[model samples]
Target: MGESVAWVAVDWGTSNVRAWGVSADGGIVASARSEAGMARLTPEAYPAALDLLLTDMAIPAGAPLEVLICGMAGARQGWREAPYLEVPAELGGLALSAVEPLGTRPGLSARIQPGVCHKGVGSEDVMRGEETQLLGLSRLLPGFSGLAVLPGTHCKWAELDGRRLTRFGSAMTGEVFEALAQHTVLRHSLAGDVVESEREAGFDDGVEAALARPERLLSSLFRVRTGALLSGKSPSWCRGFLSGLLIGTEIAGFRNWGGDEEVPLIGSTALCALYGRGLAAIGRKSRIVDATDCTLAGLRAARELL
Candidate 1:
């Protein structure tokens, strides 16, 4: 089969961008990834950046090539503000709320998918690209209804009621770990990364401890330094313990808000594995789903709606 035909799917984020030339039958024909994400581009430069990324794709010259974009590209400060659709939002109907950005050349027809939001009585929360992944999960599983744990700098736990997002919450577990490891006194005690290879390096112990007493998290965090200063703990062990403590705390907190026993874990494989470990320690299990697969599938679902 020659490289040619129909539309595109672009997942644009703060640090990187990925574009896929999709065929009519929902297969990817050509793809490209670049560092020209929302952080690097000005409003007027979006069209040019997209054009540059699609340079090698064999889209025929004539009618404008359709491009569906998601993520930070739809942020208020992005190319054009694709307003947030308030939850309970319909995953299948996301395409109906797309917005078009300005300065598009005649050769391209681009639209941005709006993010999802939740407005409580006083506090409010929002999500950008993850909604597509939720839609993809729904599409991929046909009728999946459970708690989805999307691990990231800001971990999101979303409740999917069939194809609609009923409610969700975020936990700054990763960010908190970073801050504790880098800015706090724990810096001297912990390793630069989380537990990756070893098994019994203090991770499970920390998880169990935190699960039992999440209310003592602030004090528990400081104990990392004390463990190194007094008992001569290894930095690697301290890191694993700290990682597990934070993740386990996150899981414990989610339990308060509510969660399912069999959770759908999304995003980075390594991070999800860490979360899976924490969940397992608390009698819950998780199935990891690659974020890329969900993104592509979601774009297809949106394209179908369009």
Candidate 2:
């Protein structure tokens, strides 16, 4: 795609940075990525990171390029603090809440998109990259109303009513799985990466068990260890079972907390597939939306507001 770059969109997360060169109509014409995510950069070091991804674009001459970013780059500990937009907020105007950083490269205007916060809901919860993806769904399909799940290290379940993110919740499914599989007795039994027949069966079994008794999650967790020791379960099965148990428990908890409409899972393909499987296990349904598509649409949406 040798099209001239009219603007740039970026999703700057904790571990990496991605950029897309777009035409005036917001169609992505070029793309690149860098390892210099927020966790590796200080305020002054941000420009070089941007430089890594914004180079050699067919930028229009004598015109300043526009750059819109979302994700951890806006966190308090990120490149620059872009603050959080309090909940009950409409998704369309996220860019209005964004903040301009002081030291972008020459001929570039940059703003970091703000995250959303829910202070007085059931508990205090906040999100960064996930919000842009949510906004993208509304952009990709206007007047879209329903529940959406953005799954990752901390999976977010957000509610959309009348185009506003009315309320949402987060689940630490990935982190918990990491801890339980590496630090506990379960680690010894979850050392394999193969997902053959035994693994798939274990996964389904774990999901069913969680949905059947969401209340007994704690006790069910230990079953991995016992099954491995006495029942002669394979390490692959333990991995699948532990993964299913955590993801299934999360789905069950969400169902208990009013997750009734069709959920469009916004994230990577493989992760969303796993969530889709878990949902199908409990008689629920979901659709997958690639995170790249969401980020681009979201950044474009934010750019239009500017």
Instruction: Give the whole-model CA lDDT for all candidates, comma-separated.
Output: 0.85, 0.83
- Per-residue CA lDDT of model 2 for 1-306, tens digit only, reads 534677788899899988888887767788888888889999889877787676645444336887888999898888889888888877678888889987776777888889999888469999998888887888876777878888898999988874588888999998898888889988888877686888888888899899899788899999899989899989888888888888899999988543556678887788788899998887778889877788787777766765
Alpha carbon lDDT of residue 183, candidate 1? Answer: 96
Clashing pairs in 2: none
TM-score of each: 0.93, 0.93
Taking every candidate in turn, the Cα RMSD to the unseen true structure, in Å, is 2.1, 2.1
Error at 203, model 1, angstroms: 1.8
lDDT of 2 at 245: 88
